[model samples]
Target: MPLGQRPGDKSDARYCGVEVLDFPAGEDLPAVLNHSLASAFDFILVPLVDPNYRPAPGSVLPVSASDLILGPAQWSNHVVGKISEWIDLDSEDERLRLDSELTLKQEIAWASHVSLQACVLPAPRRSFCGNYARVVNQILQGLTNMHLWLRLPLEKSEPMDDDLDKIKNNSHTSEIVDSWELWNSFRLLCDHSSQLCVALDILSTLPSINSLARWFGEPVRAAILQTEAFLTNAKGYPCLSKRHQSLLTGFFKHSVQVIISGRSNHNVFPVSEGVLSGDESYAEDSRVRHALTPYLEYIAYLYRKMDPLPEQERIEINYRDFLQSPLQPLMDNLEAQTYETFEKDVVKYTQYRRAVAKALVDRVADDAVSTTRTVLMVVGAGRGPLVRASLQAAEETGRKLKVYAVEKILTLLLLFIV
Candidate 1:
């Protein structure tokens, strides 16, 4: 009952509500059709590139030449002969004769004229190719128009002088007149004026602005103030309208916020309202840590500077405290292990040592061996697990022992030493 597949071998059943099957090359058409019927399939979606699939000779015939012109017509002809016939012409001359006889330039002009005519018409619609040609023509025409406008002088010509006077006399109308004059002058200059000389003149005038500013600084400032006043009062100007003005103000405020905050609204902040309240699902504490890392280093630098101790004393104290920390026992344990045991045990010891080594290097110089010895004292000599391990390492390595046991509980210290 699925589309395109017949129900059974019975002629009546095959004809009754079933659709016809489409087969490709190398496929056993009868077998495929039979399989589809047995499976109750109305249609099979097969690719044109499949080895078993070939469309019938005229199955894909296009309605017109426009459709046939885009793709591989030769391969298309082999698959669909009707399309080939529709597109086939005796010669290029015949094809050209069938179409308009305009050259490329004339065709462009004609197309633009057609589009301009269409634009003026009510609900004008064109075929796809016609639309494409019209669009190309419209663009070319726009460029041509612009070039023509640019050819005129910046100052008003004879016919435009009346409009210019009307604009200058009425302050309210000046902007519109100025804009129109500028645009028309630009167009005329582009089309008829010597552009190279105009460009050179423009380049030469850049230094004049600075020279004028130097000579008449107050005049420049006054002119700027007057321009601002004009813009504020320009009723017809889109940017001076209340809504647009508010929108621009909002945009400027947002831009300032983005600059000060170091991120735009779209970027995630390190500490946001939702994150602070634990309501944000994707808040990463690591990002906060990353943002604060430089600040943390700065704090540490300030703390060091403000410390009461002399530099030498601070170095000694830091080194002694670090070396005598719990890290010593861990290092001794790592050094005592066999190669196989070391592989397993050394990782933890190495991590601890590296951390301590980095801290020492940052706080004290590399030649501070006295501080290392002080660290050994701070770790203590009592027979705790750490102390016992250190003793065992000393026995194995035949190294001299120096240790200090600091325990608040007298009983535990006594038991440890014993």
Candidate 2:
């Protein structure tokens, strides 16, 4: 279920997810998934393969559970696959590097086999990740439906002062090394493939406000909220700080799904008597509260607290963050459909008519309304919406007017004297 229902809101941001820390082995993924869904989480970010397994010759991949455990629809709709974190393609050892690449590919194949919508790749080990980008680019060439999200920390460390004495003494001052640069580099290398996206790991401390704002323009699919990032409330319930709340609101506006990660810090609810850890037989119902239920509840509270989206904004919500190439009206004429679309904005034309009326009233004095004439010019007047507005304004103000409509693309320039 979504956090809350707002009229005209169909954004994915309404959904919240939890990151599964432990592997659900022995065909137990269904029970875990059921419990999480019952706890009100819309989805789960789960490991596709066991974390302990390393690639070996002729050895089958140790997936968490058989593909039959969950139906195709459940896998695609409710699960986000997590690639193994141990795979580091940039490692110095050749054996480790080969194994890492193979494992990454195998896990991705398994995710695709299950028809998972998206998979989160592990963060780059060091600053330089050219090899990582190359492998991902190769994978992207063949993928038809699945999207790959490159996970990275929201901010990295950069040395502010390079004084040798302070550096040697371990007292050198350091500042954030804007992670956007890292993402920018990776995306550029991959030719900015649309299938590639970002999943930011939000820690306890956020970067400067201006630095943080840079992410709003990027293709951020999810924000992984660490459990430690939550501050304890007055009543000991989980809550976010003011800055965190503001950032979360921004994310919600951009349709970025939030995933609660890490161990449960607040003991807001007591565990039932018979439930045991790693027990698949336990009832997967609402009666058994999940450990991360408090955090999820707080997230839902934040979501519900948001004001409903404005009606006009809801109309344009589909194109909110869409990227499009610039159009050149001077070089080529716009299609008739384009002109019709803009002319259909009744609200815009109404405002234009009102403004023109006010200007006409001010230009011609009340005493000279019938005696003096006002001259109005509408530049680039495509389809004459403004021309009509000017004529209406002249009638409303009872002022004699001479109007000129100039459109460069059109062969004829219209002149109207009223």
Judging by TM-score against the true structure, name the best candidate: 2
Q: Mark the 10 consecutive residues where model 1 has the least summed lDDT.
A: 218-227
TM-scores of the candidates in the order shown: 0.13, 0.82
Once superposed on the true structure, which residue ranges of model 2 sit more than 4 Å away at CA? 156-176, 272-285, 324-388, 391-399, 402-418
Error of 1 at 308 (Å): 55
Candidate 1 error regions (>4 Å):
1-375, 380-383
lDDT of 2: 0.85
Q: What would you estimate as the lDDT of candidate 1?
A: 0.26
Winning candidate number (lDDT) = 2
Q: Write the per-residue lDDT of candidate 2 for residues 1-418, one digit (tens) a residue.
A: 8988877779999999988887778657887787778878888998888899997778999998888989999999999999999988888888988898999989989999999999999998876888888899989998999999999999845444555557768776443366899899999989999999999999999888887899999999999999999999899999999999999999999999999898878977774312213366565556878888888889889989899998777776876777766777778888877776567677898999999899888888999987898888888887788989889988988988898888886433433322
- Residues 119-208 of candidate 1 have per-residue lDDT tens digits of 111111111133323332344455332110011111212325776778778744533322223333333433423211110001101222
Q: What's the true lDDT of residue 281 in model 1?
A: 43
